[model samples]
Target: MEELDEDNMNEIKDKHEIGTPEDHLSEIMEEAEKYHPGYGASVMTGDVLIHALEIKTTSFCTLRCKDCTHLIPYTKAPAHMPAEDLMDDIKKIIRVAKVAGLIFMGGEVMIYPQLAELMEAYSKEGFYDRVGFVRVTTNGTVVPSDEFCAAFRKIKNGYVVISDYGILSSNRDEAAKKLESFGIKVNVIPEDLQWRSLGDWHHRDYSKEEAEELYRKCHGKLYLHLYRDHLYHCYRAPVMNEDGLIPHSDGDYLDIGSMSVEDLSRRLPEFLTGLSCTKSCFYCDGFHEQSPFVERAAQL
Candidate 1:
């Protein structure tokens, strides 16, 4: 997928000198039709194709990192969705959409009890073609069970992204070794890696124009977070809503469980590409070039 073109967006902003929030939203959505990460119009006309899907299997983490991007620490009542619960949405998504990657993520996916069962569900039964590569992202706090390893090996196109946070993630190496032993691919991110501060749950107080501009500047558009059964343009939507930090807004996300596959195909592009910015955007510092960098995995 191509990155957002700041220059093109700037030209539109400069040329139109858009005034009203409603008007600017309309203009932005119209411009979004041209080209952007989630701006695939083919789903409306031809095929339902999604570049990627980040599925949150669990919100329960072992450590409480102060600057966690997903805001995992803030969730008062974190959850762990069973494989069976997730499979329904998985089945619904793959039914109409050709997903490039099926990413299973969490506060710490390694701790998710049904990891093995989830892996088997996506990797087998001709689901490979529908859902391209499967990925399991972990914080490397714990090693996987033998059953999980066996299931992971069955994935035709799958790998693990394990973050190594020095002493915090002592089992990082051992976990990778275990997965590799099962012939499962692994990518271990360095402990000292930099992280952008996603800020606390508060209103940014940006005006309509500024809010739209902030959305344009953000790079998180590609990080389409599927929380529970709801699909959101921003990854923080789930956390913000779950924690009651933000007001409820229907336009912010799609309730995928209630919608049909055809409804999803119709709304997916609109939801992903059409939105100027979600309410959660006001609370997030965002991941972008101009954003401030911070230390990684500083536990509270």
Candidate 2:
């Protein structure tokens, strides 16, 4: 290889620096037009499209990792949501908007008792057609069941995102192999993954302009939370809300159970844009680019 200069080395080192806040804003705003800016095309055509949203299936995980932004390790009584309710919510969401990437999230998706039922429902509803793609994450501790393997194969554009934390995620390789054998995509999370620690739950008391800038700049904004029937604009907010760490916000979340198609059409676009920073913003480290790093998957 040729000699690398200082500027070239710096560029490689800061690869994760996605860009400045203006870059993020420009990209989000530009993409908004395609994803029903007024919630128009999806509602009128039935050929739906909505910004990506993640479903929080459970907080129970195999390992109690330190400095988890979701604070998964700190949840005293991590529990699963009623599968029936989640399915209902999924159906309602699919009816209103096209999901970009319908993710099956959890404490440990493999351990969820009613996963088969949810997978069955996913197949039955033709979600494969409605979604851009389907993704399920795992930590490689649980072996893949034949039923789930079959269900995964049924997904037209589905993939497994796995992590290998040595013994903790021992079954990771097996899961990947089995998933691949079934003609499904298996994505191994890179070992050098970077996790930004957002600190403890207490409020930071950020001013309006500070909070707005913080909210607009972070990728946490993209990590929208779908808990119970509400769609929160930020992933950390709902988790922190459930943990009673952050004050509740009526304005920050969408009552998915209450909204009509027209209501959903208008609101989802706004929800995705996340223009107004919520109370969670004040308490959050903003998952900012400059936030301190936590070693990925560091067990408690």
Candidate 3:
């Protein structure tokens, strides 16, 4: 290959920079229309199926990891989400698609009081059979009660996913053993595994096309979330919205409670793959895995 001069290199790098915010927004709107067509003209729910659905059961976290995607430390006060409302949302979701699994998450899911009850109720409603997997994510801070373990065991493919934060977490091993003793499956994400920053407080500088390319390459794009009765298309949108980092307006998510099942089907693909980037993407680091992995959950 021929060598590129300094000027050529600079020119190539410049191609990636996003223009002014006004211009960027204009580009996004134009591209959204191209891919999604009618842009926000109607509610068209139909045959949209989602693979994994995330439920934030609580916003309380015992450990404050400096780089939490959920922005838990920024929370003014911890709050428990009523399990009844969550069940109602899940009911709305299953009507749209055959979800492969449900991910119960939080600042730390174990801290949620209604966890066992929610798991048992979802299991009784045939969610275990319908989705095939039920995963509860925890930061390894607290040990779960025996009643919780019993409820987890009742699901056909239920498991606990412990984020092993090394020195920061005291009870990881104990919690895993406790669940396994009750015949529940446990999967531990060791401290060594790499977690690429979903954009650490700054968005990647990218042209509209470049941002779309990054969105296509992101695995986390599939990790959709449901909160406050709305269905979001990705993991970042809902949490970042709570942080006041992005507009939580109607354009950001689907109102699952009111939209008809057919309307949801028609709109699902557009939400999933239509947009170039949310305004939040500018505040994020984008999915650059080449960035070195920091120690998991370093204290804030």
Which candidate leads the pack in lDDT? 1
lDDT of 2: 0.71
TM-score of each: 0.82, 0.83, 0.77
lDDT of 2 by residue, 92-115 (tens): 778767766567888788888777
Question: What order do candidates take by TM-score, descending?
Answer: 2, 1, 3
lDDT, candidate 1, at 186? 92
lDDT of each: 0.73, 0.71, 0.68
Candidate 1 TM-score over all chains jointly: 0.82
- The sequence of per-residue lDDT tens digits that candidate 3 reaches over residues 1-300 is 022354644554443443343454355334334333443232235545455688988888898766566667766556788999888778767765655557899878898999889887877886533463577898888999887888878876667889888867789999999989998878898876534345454445677776666665554456678866677766777667765655445676788767766787777778866867665555555544332334457667
Ranking by lDDT: 1, 2, 3
- Candidate 3 lDDT score relative to the true structure: 0.68
**Clash count, one per candidate:** 0, 1, 13
Q: Write the per-residue lDDT of candidate 1 for residues 1-300, one digit (tens) a residue.
A: 112255644444343342443443344334333222343332355665565678998999999988787888888889998788688787887786766566789988988889888887766766754554577888888998898999888876678889888899978989999999999889898875556566777788788777788788765665567887787776777888866778766677788879988887777767756788778787776665555555568888
- Better model by TM-score, 1 or 2? 2
Residue ranges of candidate 3 with Cα displaced over 4 Å: 1-47, 202-206, 257-263
Q: 60, model 3: CA deviation in Å?
A: 0.6
Error of 1 at 46 (Å): 3.8
Question: Model 2: runs farther than 4 Å from truth?
Answer: 1-15, 20-49, 258-262
